[model samples]
Target chain A: MREDASISINEIQEQIIREMARLDDWMEKYEYLIDLGRDLPPMETALRRDEYSIAGCQSQVWLMPRMRDGRMNYVADSDAKITRGIIALVLRVLNNQPPRDIAAAELYFLDRTGLRSNLSPSRANGLAAIVKQMKAAAAARMNT
Target chain B: MVFTGTTYKKINTAQVLDVDKVRKDFPILARRVNGRPLIYLDNAATCQKPRAVVKRIVDFYTRNNSNIHRGVHALSERASGEFEAARETVRQFLNARSTREIVFTQGTTDAINLVADSFGADFLSKGDEIIVSGMEHHSNVLPWQRICARRQAALKVLPCEHNGRLRVEDLDRLITENTKLIALVYVSNVLGVRNPVEEVIRRARARGVPVLLDGAQAVAHFEVDVRALDCDFFAFSGHKLYADTGIGVLYGKEQWLRILPPYRTGGGMVQSVGPERVRYAGLPLKFEAGTMHVAGALSLEEAIHYLRKLGFDSVRAHQRRLMDYAEGRLRALDGVTVYASPSRRYGAVSFTIDGVHPYDAGLILDKLGIAVRSGTHCAEPLMRKYGVGGMVRASFALYNTRDEVDALIEGIRRVQELCGECKSTRSLQ
Candidate 1:
């Protein structure tokens, strides 16, 4: 592991812990998750929508990002109501986090939110793929 | 123009889709969904109708809509002619022995249930076993499950091999003298993996066990000749193959259809009615009960012509190129993990990104005018097997292109930042 990257990795971990602790209920936490998705910078109109859609999602979303300081910085939006809420939750914890840390981000918050437990097996799957994609982007940043 | 991030080259999507011509064919594709252009990726559920199919339905209802066989009215004769002609077209489609062997039903699900209730209910017994594959859609899987349960028989599943293909070794292990049936999907709706149904059926036949191929996905993307494959039964939905939704085909061997009892007993199927027992007509009529979806069948013929014009081989090849482009570009991106290995499968890819949910991924893609499917894809068992609760599946038909793929790739990257990391995988081989 690169010595300098470790410091940033820990920073993300520390923030996630702090954020999780501060929130009292899943409802509050979900709001926080939405906030995370909201933090994702807006992608340019051209890159936001086209053909990059994953099938079986009930909503339309556009995602784009840039590499900054060797970490992934994302911009995303969604047309559907609930999906945008879900995206915000994902962005809150992972944005600006390094690849290794992002890859390693735990699902305890999801467990606490009861989102994982309640999602139809399919919805849970979509969650996993999105999380996997983010870590992959971070890993690519590290590799690059 | 297709949307793109600043980092990627912008794609002018207008050049990709012949907007006016193509959009005209599909009336629904032109409509807006959630205040955006309706980018349809729900073809696996059921495809939208082309003008040919829509027009056929309109003509049938407007001019000659009537019941088949018994009707003597002018409208009845015309409708009956059109309906029988539709059956002949289906025979050619499957290359069946004759139109008599082809039975119409509500859909693929109904077709399989009809076979299960008829052939399975009669020949299969308490000790018999039924074999299905890991890649079967729920429609193919459940009927066998219920039939086996009712008969006190065992239901065996062929395991999925690495890269999502069915293991023939497992098929062999599952086959035995008491094994009466093997039902499987020719191509998976989720993983887009192709199964070697011919080889599997050949082995099953060697053991004297019959096989049923669910051709719902296969009918659209590939050519099928049931005679050459020599499978005992083949079932598929017309909608998936470009026809109307209510119609589907259940093709059986002439001898099998003759022996198996009718699934539903009603008005048109019986030759002579008696208080004690009603005598049923032969073959196709025995299986077809009630007033059938005549106009839907007629529209299906038009759907077949649409496919003929595009040429299925060419369509599959075109889809492959797009799948290759999608597989390469998305899998190369950070945080993308593809579910299937690159092979000569149908045009579909299931994947996960590290930070974002599949639902979230879909919503973002939708906002960008790119539509996709997310969730278990109606294969909860398969989902459990994959160890992912669900996935994002991007499937394609004839009209998709390289630009759409590229746009998807770049869009995923942006979506990634919102989630934290994107971990899409490329096919290793």
Candidate 2:
């Protein structure tokens, strides 16, 4: 986790965009994402239940949220490696932020990196779905 | 291009097809995707239209654009003549008894729903049973399920074997006095196995029960003779047979068609309407309610013409050769498992890589410009039968070649290499 909680979501998003732009081709970009996904800490088996599972995904995905010191954090995992890599990218930009910031953050990095187009729109569950769930979770916390 | 005797001789041999020549007829096959030549292996989902079918659609709208069956003008007569002629074409294609027996539907799903709704309304009651094979697509399963639920009837399943072939022996025992209908897929979309529909129809006939074969996948790869098979009803989609979507056929025996009420009732499907009661139209017209897909029906006629030009024997031989080669190559792979090793198969070959999720493999393959279907394939029960979340399918059509199958093999290897490390840690459960 980064020590600087003061960093804005836009700054983190720009950093991600810069990192992705460095890759020359789709293969290199995917390799980078695979490495990032592999480095993510594995979610506990106890939390990986059907209750946390998201529907409409081609593969199984589990997402859970936690509030740490009034900051919103998500723990997610997917059976598919590519989907996990995508979830990893999403978590990097939105994790460890306050509920309002997490809820209001614009995820432009996915579109800028051309990853959004790669995910088929017919599949209702993908990057867009994960972001919706995260934002909804953040919104739920705001009422408390 | 018009198919003449010379075209047949130039493109087809005794039991083989000149696939290179055949590929030229479908212009989309030439386009590139993701900087690579597109390898289309999703024929079971739908097929690419030939030049003849495309041109027929354009020709219909440009020259013969008029409402069919109701117009008194010259354009209307021409359009109506062409539309009914298309019906005759479908009648000949299926070897149906009469043109009146063929009903135009939206697709296979709509065709199945028509039979389920109309038949269920007329014949079914509390405790009546409908038998369907376990390997049927959702289109075949859900209609019966919903009707059974609505009418307080029972939906009985004839389960498939572990290898995905339906057990025909169990059919005799499953049918009883309560059984009103037997619906089965002529060819499974996912497993690619041809169910023993002939034997099934014969058995169902012995019990005085009618059989409806979902021929959405069968019509593309082989000839279908509804009369010879003695199936009470046969349904298929036009797009699967190299034509446009939203147009399909439902072939019902005239005896049954006379007794059953119309599935959908509206304009052009009525003889008269009065203040007290409305009298519906006769035979096929009673079933078609709204303005039909006139262009689609005509394109279907053209598609049938295209297939007849290629010859069904050649189409069957070409598909069998490709499937045999694909299954052999797939089985030789170290970490791949091919599903449903039936003696007779067509249109599709389903398999899964040992460690990688099918969606992951599908995505990586798409990046390489290879299009394959990678989900449950709308046959969730069949997926459950095989104890798999999903399987990757490489479906073939007459235009496909051995070289394309080779490319698919290579694409699978690349997917394995890219996602190999994640295999150990990935677990769906």
Candidate 3:
């Protein structure tokens, strides 16, 4: 978890949008996202249980959450590269944030950057499922 | 493009029907998508409706739109007549013994559930086995699973080869005294392989077990005769046959329809509901509860008529040519791997490319105005068997053209070029 950094979800979302906007084409943007996925930290094999998996995703995605210093820290991975990329974008906004902030945060960067509409129905569904699982994990930790 | 030689002619033996004329029937085919001409190769999902079917639906809504079988009004009588006439069309389409055997449901899924629920409730008992192929779609498998769970019956799978062909030779060992029914897919939507349903049916008949064939993919391209097949039950959806989405047909033998209870008991399915006791309506009507999709049934009849006009011989020939072209194109691609080289395959052609996800391939194809189906295709078990996450499937119909197949090839090449860097140079083996 990056304890030194504390940026609002909106600011992080804008940063992502700005980075994505630098790319001229959809292919370039997708390639950048795939690279981000490749560079993202791999989830621990021990944490990859079925309970942590998100349903309704076209790809098999696992999300494991941990409470580190009152903030929700998540580790995620997916079988498909594009899905992994989408999940990486999702994790960037919500990871290492306070449980309440994570749960309440409306991650609108995907829609603002035109990623949501440009995505195929199943891809959009996979992204939504990942977001839902992340929020649910945050909410669960908050409750506990 | 040189389609010369007897081999080509032998493959498409049916007289060359005017494809350009057939293409004109579908208005949507002329339109463009994503700045490119729309090349629809997703026929396995649902076929595009011709002008005839569309005009029939519009005409029904404009003139004779009324609830069937209840009212005394002229519109109701006309609608009732049309709906029953549609039933007769389906009866003739499948060459069923009688109209009394045909029951309309929401679609193939609904039809399968009707049989699985009603038949399982009536006949299935504890420890009884319902045999289904591994290649069966979730629709055919899930309903039976639910019913088996409820009735303490076991749902046994008839295993298929890695290429998705079921081994009917193992039928002797698989079917036991406890086996009640054998359910199979007449044509696999994924592999596009026509299963040895006749052999399976003969085997089941020997064991005195009734067989149910999911003919959702078969009815459009092949000549489906329920009487000739002698299968106990056959189910298919209208949408895949170029008809409306919400309409489907379930054809059961009279003996079984009489023996099995009603799937859903309601107003239309009752003889007389008195205070003391109620008697169910006979045969087909007993299965069709409440208000049916009257307009959909009529439109389905039009779709059937359109298909009949084209004739199955030309339709089959056209489909075979498309599949052959598609298979050849896919096999020629460096990274592309075609799945299930079944002997008697038609219509659908599924493949995977190195270092590209099926969804990614499908997305790129969509951008190029080539629509194809990606992912498990409702056959998750088959995916698991093949050890692939998902596959991109480009299916054909009578309406699909050689030019469209060329566009699909170009689209795939574009996908490869775009995602080339991301692809690992590792061996697939």
Candidate 4:
């Protein structure tokens, strides 16, 4: 799939939901996620420090955000593959989008993929934290 | 199905538990998680409550619900009688000298905090030392840490061995004249190793230092005789013993409870309160303040009765078989590291798989309807000592079976396979 700036956040989310719908069971869905996580570009080692880490996650997650040409770009990584995969999915929808779009975007694709359970606040898997951090970062950029 | 009257008699006669029969008593066991039969291996977190316990709670709320120790009416007197009777049950359960020794609290954490606050305030002074083990759950560690900070006392630690044993031999050097209290876990929640607490208690006694055993993990697996152990203090949670949450026991010696001032003060805990000064109530009531968890206490009593009916011999034997099978099966698997494979283990077996994070394994296991605990299991210091971020723990209970262990083993293999495929396919990509 091309990283097209022309695609809207909802369109990408729909695309993700449609892609996830093709998987028959949780195993296949997880496998697809694992592949996505494995393919994600590694975050710069210097940026993966304690300051970038999210608290309350069972796995160690580091999320770093940058603004490029009035758009948000997030570089995130997790020690756990499943969490990394979940973050990869989140970034797929929001990455390179305008800060306003990123901030206001509703992540319905996570629920559609049957992966929302992992994003529960009680689960503390870092997906929820990642999404919150991404939006908060975008909102912060909008003020500047 | 209420295991109240005749069912007790039936269970007492049977030497070993009918495992299936025992499993039936816990309603949650029959339910499915995800799409498969639930394999609950997280008993160390909290055991499933039996029907008798639930019924006891409901029965109390339905009929004998009233403020205890205050009311002169029929319901109040009945409620107070049953509440004190629950204390007596706990007293008998731990074989304490009197009901005076059994003080109720919210749970193990609350009990420990009670002791730390009361005892530390009364006994500890600047430069006085308190000893705790490296493997203690944060509950055991944090209370003493706070108290020590307040008292300006030193907190000494008995380091855990590489193989997961507390270094008991170091107690002589650690237990100086300045040592006020030695708090330790009776069972390691992470390693499953039952610490050599008896020897530590004996050694501490000789040195005139009081010892507190955090028996939160111990009480559920075996019988605890406070008199036999001769420890100054023992703390355990009711929920871990198949009873309700929000109730626990802090068994103190008569001498200790007599001197340790009240932890919380309120309406129920006072003999009289005047404008100028106040007089505290005696013994157990001094510690129990306000309207207690009357239902929780009553349910705990029923849970004890239920356990006594099943018999500790049976519980021990069954748990032993499951642990042995689980340890054997887990040890057989390649690329798995079982922490603290001590000669004596109880309740939980914690480990990690190579190239697979414990969190990921837990996620997959949850999907398969096999519940497990991952991450540090609330013992981060121990995890740091072992040089791991987290571990997968499968903790067993009386209702848990060899079949569940088999399921856990299979589930672990599935985790390894799924995570392994991700790596292999990634290498190809």
Q: Please, what is the whole-model Cα lDDT of each candidate in the order they appear?
A: 0.73, 0.87, 0.84, 0.89
Ranking by TM-score: 4, 2, 3, 1
Better of 1 and 3 by DockQ: 3
| RMSD value for candidate 1 | 14.4
Stretches of model 1 off by over 4 angstroms after superposition? A1-33, A36-144, B1-24, B421-429
lDDT of 3 at B376: 88
TM-score of each: 0.73, 0.94, 0.91, 0.95
For residues B1-429, could you state the per-residue lDDT of candidate 3 as single tens digits? 235421233442446656777889999999998677888989999999999999999999999999888899999999999999999999999999999999998899999999999999889999999999988889999999999999999999999997767899999899999999998999988989899999999999998999999999998778999999999999999999999899999999999999998888777889999998889998799999999988788889999999878877777777887788778888898999988888767778789999888877876787678899988899999899989988999998888877778788888888887666654332212
Please give, for residues B12-126, the per-residue lDDT of candidate 2 as tens digits. 4554577888999999999998778999999999999999999999999999899988999999999999999999999998899899899999999999999999999989999
In candidate 4, what are the lDDT values of residues B219-322, reduced to their tens digit? 97888899999999999999999999999999999999999888988889999999989999998899999989999999899999999898888787678767
True contacts kept of each: 0.12, 0.34, 0.16, 0.41
lDDT of 4 at B212: 95
- Quality of candidate 1 docking, DockQ: 0.07
TM-score of chain B of each: 0.91, 0.95, 0.95, 0.95
Evaluate model 2 with DockQ and give the value: 0.42
Per-residue accuracy of model 4 over A1-144 as CA lDDT, tens digit each: 335548899999999888888887777777777778887988888888888988654787889899987788888999888888888888888988888888889999888888988878644566777788899999999866
The alpha-carbon RMSD over the true interface for every model, in angstroms, is: 11.9, 6.0, 6.1, 3.0
Tens-place lDDT per residue, model 1, B1-429, is 232321123253212323234446777777775466666665666777888888889988888877888879888888888899999999998999899999999888999999998977798899898888877778887888888889998988888865886788776777888888888888899988878888898888888888888888888777899999999899999988778888999999988888898999997899999899889988799888899998889988888877776555555655665667677786787777888683665757889887666766775666566788877787877888877756888887665555667667766875675455322221112
Question: What's the lDDT for candidate 1?
Answer: 0.73
